[model samples]
Target: MAVSDECKIKFRELKAKRSYRFIVFKIDQQQIVVETLGGPNQSYDDFTSSLPSNECRYAVYDFEFITAENCQKSKIFFIAWSPEISKVRMKMVYASSKDSFKRELDGIQFELQATDPSEMSLDIVKGRAI
Candidate 1:
């Protein structure tokens, strides 16, 4: 599947202007498109809750976290969420198409794939930030 031009533009807006807190993308009509965007005020819980329990999606989250040294830092995380309950065929398609999709985003700082939410839990994200 190809990444749509709107997807690229939205990513650029998120990266350059912090226009969004998170972006959820999905395969639509053979193109990867933005399904929804979290506003800057949205929390991590909000983003996580936005994900459907039985689906596959690609997301980018702006994670602003406090470091062990008591400093503030932010990282852009590219996450591929494919739950075990989702269709195997859909998982395969998402897995195979990930590289091509993320490559177009330009500034993702961390890459994570989750077959289960625990794998991409807050602790894991914090660990990556550390």
Candidate 2:
């Protein structure tokens, strides 16, 4: 999916603020793509602390896991969304595990796509969605 310039700008601003342990791009109303940066033992507080202060209609926390081959894999383990701050406060819909703070990406309204960590581009982090 193509990201707009506006979204890229928002991403860059958030990166500059060090606001997100992971970054997910809302491709559309029903789809979001994400890349995880945190370790396997990441905490919920640490996760929330990384969120951008700016409004994000929807977001998914990508949890990284090590596979049998020692490859890192990501899975959507948490979801958050806010229609409008004035109307409703942003909330976390799910958490993966009590100890792991992980949740499976299933039955979500928005399709969460997990991309390769290497796919995360500096341009996107700099607010230029390439």
Candidate with the greatest TM-score versus the true structure: 1
Tens-place lDDT digits, model 2, residues 39-88: 33565445554444444433444444466688774443334433233222
How many collisions per candidate?
Answer: 0, 7
- Per-residue lDDT, model 2, residue 29, is 39
- The superposed Cα distance between candidate 2 and the true structure at residue 23, in angstroms, equals 7.3
Cα lDDT listed for each candidate = 0.92, 0.36
Residue 32 lDDT (model 2): 34
Model 2 has an lDDT value of: 0.36
Summing lDDT over every window of 10 consecutive residues in candidate 2, give the lowest-scoring window.
94-103
TM-score: model 1 vs. ground truth = 0.95
Question: What is the C-alpha local distance difference test score of candidate 1?
Answer: 0.92
